[model samples]
Target: MAGPTAAPTRREPTPDEFVAMQQSPEFQELRSTFRGFTFPVMIVAFIWYVVYVLLATFLPETMARPFLGLNVGLWLGLAQFLTTFLITWIYVRWANANIEPRAAHIRQEMEG
Candidate 1:
């Protein structure tokens, strides 16, 4: 009769190993890819928000203009929410497709 098997322990990487991993081409590529997507998106989103705020603050009359039974400001406010959801959806899809596989591969290499 066989007894219960103990689970395998994962060994933590040493500080040098961590540094080496960070410097590896695969890790560097991953970081670059992530930044390439994130930085531009962040900049654009920030600019979009700033534009909205500026319009609402400095041009209340323009924001107050009526359109399709609702004011422009209200529509823009709703668009902000929509943009949030859309960005989240895009990030999830992009990560799953481009990021996850490379990350998994790197993790597997580190573990083994």
Candidate 2:
């Protein structure tokens, strides 16, 4: 009778292997596209929120003034909420168009 055989071991990828994975065209495209869309939108959204806060804090009188039957503060405050939703919606559309397909291709490559 033969002795039982040992199970095969799984090797972890090395740091060089990890870097090569990121250097792959599919991964690079996905990373670049995600960064390209998110960075600008994030910067714009952050600046917009900061400006509104600064204006409300330093120039309260301007915010208190009425526009479109609502105080300027109210309009600007509501705009913050609207900006969040709009940015989320745009990112979703961008991911669907640009990110998902490349990610799927990478997934398929991994599987195959």
Can you write out model 2's per-residue Cα lDDT over 1-112, one digit (the tens) per residue? Answer: 9999997654566677667878998698789889988999999999999999999999999999999999999999999999999999988998999999888776555544
84 Cα displacement, candidate 2 (Å): 1.0
**lDDT for every model?**
0.92, 0.88
Q: Which candidate is the best by TM-score?
A: 1
Any runs in candidate 1 off by more than 4 Å, and if so which? Answer: 1-8
Residue 56 displacement (Å), model 2: 0.7
Q: Write model 1 residue lDDT over 1-112, tens digit each, in one string.
A: 9999999876677788889999999999999999999899989988999999999999999999999999999999999999988998999999999999999988777776
Candidate 1: minimum summed lDDT over ten consecutive residues — where? 9-18
| Cα lDDT for residue 63, candidate 1 | 100
Q: What lDDT does candidate 1 reach at residue 38?
A: 87
Query: Where does candidate 2 clash, by residue pair?
Result: none
